[model samples]
Target chain A: MNTDWKNIDAASLNNLTLGEAEKLFGLEPNFTEEELKKVRNALSRQYHPDLNPDSGNIMSKINAVYDILKNEIKNRRNAEQNNANGGATDTSSTSSDSTREEPEAENINDNAGATDNSTSENTADEPEVENLNDNAGATDNSASENTADEPEVENLNDNAGATDNSTSENAADEPEVENLNDNAGTTDNSTSENTADEPEAENLNDNAGAANNEPRNENSNITWEDVNRIGVENLTLDDARRLFNLEEDFTENDLIDAYNRLDRIYNPMNFPIGSEEAEKNRATMNSIYGVYTILRRNLINRQNVQESPTREDTTNQSTQVSMNPTNEKADNSRNDNGDENSQNIPSADNEKNDGQTDRPKDAPTHNEKPALSTGPTVGDQIASNDTTPDPEPIPVIKSIPAKIMDHRKQILIIIGIIALAIAISQAINLTLVAQMARNGNLWHLTAGVAEKAALHAKNINLTSKLIALKSSYDSLSGVWTIAGQKLLTGNLQAILRGISAGSGILGLSCLTAGLIKKKSAAYKEYKKNIRQLIRDFNDLSYDEAINQINSLRENINNSNELSDREKQLLLNQLKKAEKLNRQFEDIDQGEELEGGMSL
Target chain B: MMVDSIITLANNKNYLLLMESSILDDSYFLGVLLDDNMEPTVDYVVLKKVEKDGVVCAQQINNLNTLTQLLEEYGSEYAENYN
Candidate 1:
């Protein structure tokens, strides 16, 4: 029996993450019930053990992955449902109690009600307490009033009067609501509706503070054992958050608070360096810092992705293309990727195509891509909310020729600098050689003086003195002997002359070669730029054509050694480009003139 | 006969299972390593394939370290077959 299972191996399945597990089963993290059902049906048809009995192991892996994802999705849905139910319950309870409570006490009552059930009892028992006070009043008003009843009635009336005074002075308590709103970091509009029927949010801060205090207490009491026990090596984002004692929906402020708190305890400065305890503390601090940084970076990336998925996709693809080793292939792949991404995503595809055609080189900048901000806003709803199959943006890949054109100036400048350095060093060597030749002449003069002295001694018939002078001359001459001069039967002086001549010739040749290389490289680059300019002219990119022509001219002018013939050739090309540009302008002028005539 | 056939294929044929998760599409493939005789061997191998300019190239995942790095960079759906 044939099986359509993807054929995952054992090792691969061993370390699968929840996200990867979802992908393996072809389930989206936020997949709807219908989508999940569809995926389940499709996988079972291909990998059901009974259907494809031969691939029992493969079927088991599939079921295992599916089960994990199914449970995860089920849990997420249950959480969302519970949140919805709890919100509804809280709202109903607030509205019901606010109906009977005094306006001034409503804010305090709402806060107390949200935190504990004591406010519910307060509201429920208020009417009964008032009725008891009324009965005591009726007894005191009777002819035989009990002394116990009189004091009770007075206490009840005092309580009623106090309640009445507080409720009647609700306007005076408005300033406290403002203070509460300020403390809560909420809008003043919430406090503005206290006189209206809506439940004032004055108590929200107090209740929320009470609710947060419990978690804050627990988190503060978290021990080093709780933190150090979490292994940082394979720590995922969620695990890192847990180690930091952060909530499920932690904000940047919360992350910073956790980091600061953790850093204080684990800071190695508290311990002596080189100690085992210090080392352990240092490691703990590093892990905390790593977790904080990773969380922060992931949060920023998620924001960027959520704000403009296509732009992020485009940026990634461009980076990848830039990193590619093979220029020609990378260029083609980038274009293909752009097109492919465009097809996968609808709105982004339209924008990408518009960008590709509108400004082939610089269009991506002016197009909708740069307009996308990193911060998410409601304005991006129209652009980003489209149900594009893929969220990745297509990378605009320029061909090798275009990229070379962009960097051609920089390449030439670098080459020029290298050539200049070589020439300067060679010139310095030439001056040193001249100085060495002068030194050699001074030695020859000394030898000539020794010969003169020997001749004078011979004239005087001083044989010993003449012999000494001759020996001194021979010793002085031998110092500059070329290697293997005697074996070659060459005169030492002649060989020395030959060595000087050879070096001089070699230096001149190298200087010429360096110059020629620079000239030829520049000329080749100029030709390439001219060819690109011509192509641009043909493509009716007049502005780019003009720019290239000016650049080419500038390069030629900089190349001082360019031959007259080469300069003439470049000038002719420039003339042709300028003529074409003029023709384009004339054509535009003619169109305008025709329009004017018709008008 | 079916069980024996499955066992024989598993023991004798060098089969590499791979999944290519790309932006365009995700595809599953099996690569069979050929021996000196240009025939399939029992020893399997895993390779990382990159396609550029319509040309597809692959690099072998030789060790556990390489495999771990590959899984981290790419997703777990991709695996290299190795002997």
Candidate 2:
């Protein structure tokens, strides 16, 4: 073999020769010539791909190992030479096999059953040993430098001793399942045998293509990308090109109907009908019919594949599908896109209408002919040039416009977000303030007032009891004076009337004083003022309520006509009522204004 | 004979694998492929194990793709045509 083989791992092969291969393959005690041939044949036969084509890489490894051992006399001799220097490894090998070979009980039974081919097997191995002996004198086998165009190597058919024979039997016996790789060794890529292998590859691909329409199975990990690539690669481009020659038949009626419909519906003027774009569309529509024709032809081709007869009617292009209606529809469609395009680029259309072409004359032009050699053909040149944008260098405005668009989009989005936030906050605030105002707390204040009224009623009760006792004392005095005078005199009656009058005046003054319990309220105006204060407070009129409460308390404290006890009671009551009013004044609604609470 | 049941049993979890090892020695796409997990497939049929005895095995079965193509197109048709 040439030393410079491509892709061989030089280091790995070198080690196999002298380094550690024997140790690695667990063949430390070198194989005797006889043993090596047997192992090499066994391994090679086991993995030979042809023996088990389905084995894939498993057989290749076995084949590879056979290569190493087949001409391995050089390596075995290397070890034998090592032993000539009296190495213990060499002594062990001779010593061990001798002992094992003489095992009388096991040897006799094993040889007895094995006699079916033992004599022939031993004879078969003799020539191989002679080769090894020859190589011992000269380490390199002459076979290594043999002719490059080597004849095909025969499969070692001594398959029974060679593991292959057993597996083939194994494979044949079990028809239900295929045997795995000939042997365990990994094999190489099978690309070279194109003719023999092509069948399997196609089978796999066909299965893959139809697999898409089949329900998915879990073990199948194939993906659409895999199938699509396979479909494309496996496709015979030649087939498609040939499809053009096939007869038309599959969608005959429908194609004709569509053609007729388009002819009637379309308006050609709307299309700018003679324009290149319209012509291109027209070409595309014609090609579609071409595809339709091709597809119909394929139905027959497909039918052939299905082993079915082709549909025979409508041959020779007799049924020309009506092309009129679709032609009209195509024109109408052209008009719609034209109008939309013109509306979008009014400047272009407007210039065209003005008879001044849309092309800017002063624009820098590249790869362009001058429109004017001051030539009469300037109009034609300008129109043609206007229809095609000058292949000029990229414009500065293009970059600037892109940047401006990005910034514009970003700015608009940010501003829109900010506006939404502001509107949301305003709405939430309005809702909360409305809710707070409606919360009134009027009932809570009414609750406070009821408590105050209960206290005042207690005070009034005590005062009235005192006044009732005083009236009884006056009545008794009138009775005593009468007892000392005439039994039914007019003077006695007058004295009793005077006592009653004094008691009524005393009671009325006490009641009036008690009712005006607080200092500043003009008692007659108290209800109206207090009510107004409550209304102002609920309406967020806090400052006004505070002003009124303070004024009432101040005025009451300063008043001089009251007794010390009544004044103290009035002050106490006013202090509590004012405290409640102040609490309302300090109700910070959590919103701040530039000025104090608006009234 | 086994695993028609096994085929049914292989369920979604089972997959068939057949790889050519000879490619690793030299073939561009084939040689380097490896399954680190080492879960071997039972269903696939590997043909012409890549290399054997210091020679590439696939050299013997060239034009494999063609045979596969013929079978795909003609296999079913033959069955129906003959039927």
Candidate 3:
């Protein structure tokens, strides 16, 4: 019936996470109430998580999709029932089939809570649980056969029942999803056991039939396991060369096809992280990603190596595949897969009506799909869980409570969080204000503005605690600035006059003292010499007088030359002379005096 | 000895030594010890007056030794400059 198998191929729903989809298909999932219960019971039996073989996990993913869809339907029914009865559930007895009607393993977990041993056993019983579905399906086919103009339900698992039931095709379970989902459960654990035992038939089916139908991009089947096992054997990146009957030189498109083939099989999101299986698979997925990276790198390297004549492009060189064949590990190169890969899911009309009949009779046409996250729109809810290769939708409604409760709680929490955030923000703002005050030259700027306005404000020198101006300058800057300008312009010589005035008084006093002093002719001569010394001290260049006076002063300080009166008189005269000479000691004083400059 | 005596009195009294650098004309030497923050220290050896800074323009024992050695090395140069 899938005449347009390729055309009718619905886009895969691989992107939706199982739990998010589960929200859409809550306890009463995406499937109808009746159909959800049927699929739920069947799945609980098939994928009794703990008891299923490691390989049975592929089936578990498929069944998880189914369980989520069923739960969504159940939740919708429960919500409707709640609305009908004013929002109170009588917890009288959870055994009233409504709880069972919910698609979650919760009822089972709750039922078997007292029996821990049964958890694994319940899971182990999942494969056999489909048997009950088969019986139920038998009952439905008999009943629905007579219904006039009944819409056909697309069940995909029809053909795989060769090992189980004779009428398995008519009991097609997920027949529309056979290429993707059915084999998912098989690869993880069963590949090792099954591939080793039944390689020829299964291998041929996957390698040949699966590849062409999948297109160059749908590389979901050639799993990490396939990549790990395939080596350079029948199926390799170079496998395209054999298919097209060409040499190893293949186009980029061929490589992409091979990579896609390899990609479809590796289940990166198969299990949750930190789970034992997920951790194991993490390593495996990383290696698979690494392999793809290597293939890309190899192709690029080969292209570069061929094109570059000078080997200057040393970066493109790599050790050939055989040399590091086994060392080539899988990586998360695809784990960081971009948005383009996950962008579009299947639209409805193009879906297949493949005559997949392996599904059990009486199982609802809208079998439950794997759980995915909450979809924003109703269409998304359906689309997220629509794993069917062909969109064979059995009508579902929009009934589950919009995440209003979550939104309300979030709003309240956000209000509290924002209050706290505001307090912190305010505190930070205050600290910044304080820091800004510390940095600003508030006093200096006012002083500057004052100085700018006033004239003859005898350059006030103020050192401030606050820094304000662009240079963080204090009022002292004005003094320094005036001083520097005066210094540069040779006008600071006037201040030196104050220092020299003291010396002039002292020199005249020394002259008078020397004239009054009584002594012999030689003492009079010495007194005369002293008077001359005072005149020269006043008249001489500052350097010459300072040198002579300093020498004499040192000698007198060291010597017991005169009596106490002589010493006291000499000291007073010396103090005045030294004061006069001190102004000239400044380099600017001597220079300005000699040149008649003002600085 | 007299300066140390004055310092001892000052310690008992409420007066404070605000500035530390000592200069006579352009000839000045710094003997003050300061803390990491550059505050003057006064109490290395004293308990109550934990000197944040040191004695101003005085040769301490270590420095006296250093100065003796420096003088021995650069004594002639200094003498010439003095002359």
* Residue runs of model 3 more than 4 Å from their true location after superposition: A1-12, A15-221, A228-235, A239-273, A302-599, B1-83
lDDT of 3 by residue, A501-592 (tens): 22232122222222244634533333344445555643466678767766665655554545556555555555545554553343222222
Fnat per predicted structure, each in turn = 0.00, 0.00, 0.00
Q: When superposed on Cα atoms, how far off is each prediction in RMSD?
A: 39.4, 48.7, 41.4
lDDT of 2 by residue, B1-83 (tens): 11111111111222111112222122211111112342322112212223345433321211212212222222223223222
The alpha-carbon lDDT assigned to residue A64 of candidate 2 equals 31
Residue runs of model 1 more than 4 Å from their true location after superposition: A1-227, A233-239, A242-254, A305-599, B1-83
Q: Per-residue lDDT for A313-428 in model 2, tens only? A: 12101111111211223223323444321111112222234332334443212212323333222222322232242122211111001112322222222222222222221222
List candidate 2 stretches off by more than 4 Å. A1-20, A23-25, A57-60, A75-599, B1-83
Q: After superposition, how far is residue A468 of candidate 1 from its true place, in Å?
A: 80
lDDT of each: 0.33, 0.25, 0.28
Q: Which lDDT tens digits does candidate 1 get at residues B1-83? A: 11001111222432223222332222212233435453334333334443446543343333222222222222222111110
lDDT of 2 at B67: 19
Q: Candidate 1 residues A1-599, lDDT tens each?
A: 13335566423442345566667766656666566556655654454432343434454355445543444454455556767677543332233223223321332332341234433432343321111111111111110121113332233223322112221232133332233223434222222322132122233332113222121111111112222222232233433544454543456555554443343234433233234433454434444544554454334334444343343233222222111011223233334544322111112122233432121342221012333246543222322322122222212121111111212222222222222222221222111111111121112222222333333334333432333242222223221112112212334333222222222211212222222324455565675565455434434555766777787787787677678777876676566556646644443333322221111
> How far out, in Å, is residue A526 in model 1?
56
- Superposed Cα deviation of residue A61, candidate 1 (Å): 53
